[model samples]
Target: MKYFLYWGCSLEASGVNYLRSLKPVCEALGMEFEEIPDWNCCGASVSYAGANDLAIKVLNARNLALAEKKANYDIIAPCSSCYIQMIKVNHEIQENESLRERVNSILAEDGLAYNGSIRVRHIQDVLFNDIGTEQIKRHVTKPLNGLKVAGYVGCQSVRPYGEYDSVHNPVVQDKLLEALDAKPVPFPKKIQCCGSGIFLPEMDLCLGLVRDILDDAVSHGAEIISTVCPMCAMNLEMYQDRINEKYGTDFDIPIVYLTQLMAVAFGMDLKRDAALHHNVIPPENILKAAIGN
Candidate 1:
């Protein structure tokens, strides 16, 4: 199936590895994706934090309008924050006539408006629901036979949106790994917040939260952790060193995008995908071992 792909800001820069992985995996699955042109930022938290509801809605509406203009009703967003924002604003504009009129008023100036006909889908939903485990397994050239991976769905993908999966118990990522013939190591902290901004103001709290999650994964015998959200991956990948140093643990766990492993499991062109370049906890050797490259 073809959909308008929205790359949000992070996926292009901070999470470029995710971009690298997703393209090849989607191609492998015969899924066609075309990026929405002139897509603007979703302003994940900044717009909402300052009570700029109108500004934020307008910003999100612009992207939706762009997709609608392109005649694509389904928008596939890989970033959890971007998916949540688009879905949230789309729902609000559809349900509230007042909000819709207000947003339209602002959008009228630019000759763009959101009609709420667009459906925003996370890639996780596309992989699990649309593609299905059986279909994905058909493409697995090398099964992750002995690999143990913990699934982390994190906060943004579930709560406040709950469009694709459950907030309380999400197993989409784990199932995707299973499709690759890998062992899905379950953990209690799978759906917990990865402490996105908590690390900056309260280092202790953030460190404790991250350390606990990693500890649980390791204790469960997880060699790597797979997450769909870039923020979740970032928090786990970026701050793992501090978590280890502060907690006196020797954890060197690799946190990778679900698509990265998918590319490997599907036996796509890993070298061209360049999936191993971004994350601090590199997945090159781990993935090579899985596919016996």
Candidate 2:
């Protein structure tokens, strides 16, 4: 019912729409989120790739340390990268006793230590597991009746830890969307990678990969791509022009947060509840049709 919300760096900075939409959805779901104090980076790609693996563990451990102080050790991250990294750290420290001591040793020097008691969770997981599909359906006064939404689970959030659900084929978002009466477009690229940290060094490769994802959804008759990760949304939605220029293709698919769709189905205002500020191809027409406007 309650969780220590970890607003990852990318989410707070670039995924502002997800933040705005998620707040209202959480309130509607009867959940409370207390932000963990002084939460630092989860060592996303920069630290994990550049610095020591121990550094990544300690970086996440510091945040877990903050969460450990709370009565409930549950920490929920809306960002997929953050969710994976946080849980990855917890899993690593718990499995490797030496690594745990090394992290605790470094933490003790800074008057911080984590017991690995923190339960790192993705928002989608909490929604499906904590709040059942039937409950979610009850909140849906305005169902996405005719709209076709492709569920994009990205790569990170469900993997390595497998806490929320299976990494092979994730259907939580699909099931949740179906519960709202939206036609779930199950595409092949739903669980595929969106380039991850390869966006910088290999922009072309990343663009090509993202293009495939967009095309897959559009080809599958998806009017809107409902996503759970900020990075995936950014790559799929933010790089549209580049994707078009690179592939010489015209794709205008809109990427929305799963929570945004839920909020709309729950009778929240179209403009206010699901502003979709980050989407390059605005979801106006698609969402309007879903809302029967």
Candidate 3:
């Protein structure tokens, strides 16, 4: 199988390590992973600002055009924001020809045109759909038995304007965990927003929202929180200290990327996989305990 690896600006900057790790893993699994040729920023964070929708659509259309030239394979985005923006805007452009023409006019500058020929998908979807749970299970060199994980499907990846998965309940992460031989703990705030894009103007509000979600996960006996979004991982992992101080509680749940956990389950070296870069509480200790390491 082949895929166009689309890394948007946010991921290209701070989350490059993840892309680096995933590429090798995919290659080892006998998948052809190619970076989109002449890719540019997906105009990150601008799509949600109501008036800038056309501009965002045009920007993503450029990237899609680039991918279309490469192959007919699905464009796989590791970042949730990129996935949401690309998928949602593609849907919009296909539904509105007038809007598509307007966006194509902007793309004409770069000699790019989008006909909505390709589909945008997250790495999670590709892993589950194309790779299959049985294939993922076969890669699990070390089973994470007894490890209780709370799957956090950040808003953009599963909800709001993009309805890629179930809005109220999503089990993609759960299925991935099961393939790793890990227990998926159900929590109330699994689909809740992690205050991703609103962190700047609403810092306190973002922290409060994250705190509530973390508390719910802890209450549900989740030792670690797994997520597909880098922004969600950053907020939940990096802001835990402040959240604890403000709420008079010590919630040190480890925030792990879904890929990171899968890498570990696949028996990839934790240090080389860049799992150590996470700001949240380290999950290695808990994971070791669960596997009797």
Cα lDDT of model 3 by residue, 172-234, tens digit: 889888988888988878888878877757888898999989999999989888887778877
TM-score-wise, the better of 1 and 3 is: 1
Least accurate 10 contiguous residues by lDDT in model 2:
270-279
Backbone collision count in every prediction? 0, 0, 0
**TM-score of predicted structure 3:** 0.92
| Colliding residue pairs in candidate 3 | none
> TM-scores of the models, in the given order?
0.95, 0.96, 0.92
Worst 10 residues of 3 by lDDT: 273-282
Q: Across residues 10-69, which tens digit of lDDT does each residue of candidate 2 receive?
A: 877778778878988888989988999888988776564688877787888989988897
Residue 192 of candidate 2: its Cα lDDT?
A: 84
Flag regions of model 2 displaced more than 4 Å: none
Model 3: how far is 37 from its true place, Å? 2.1
Best-performing candidate as measured by TM-score: 2
Q: Tens digits of per-residue lDDT for model 1 on 38-82?
A: 989988854566767778888899999888888854898899889
Query: What is the TM-score of candidate 2?
Result: 0.96
Q: Model 1, residue 122: displacement in angstroms? A: 0.6
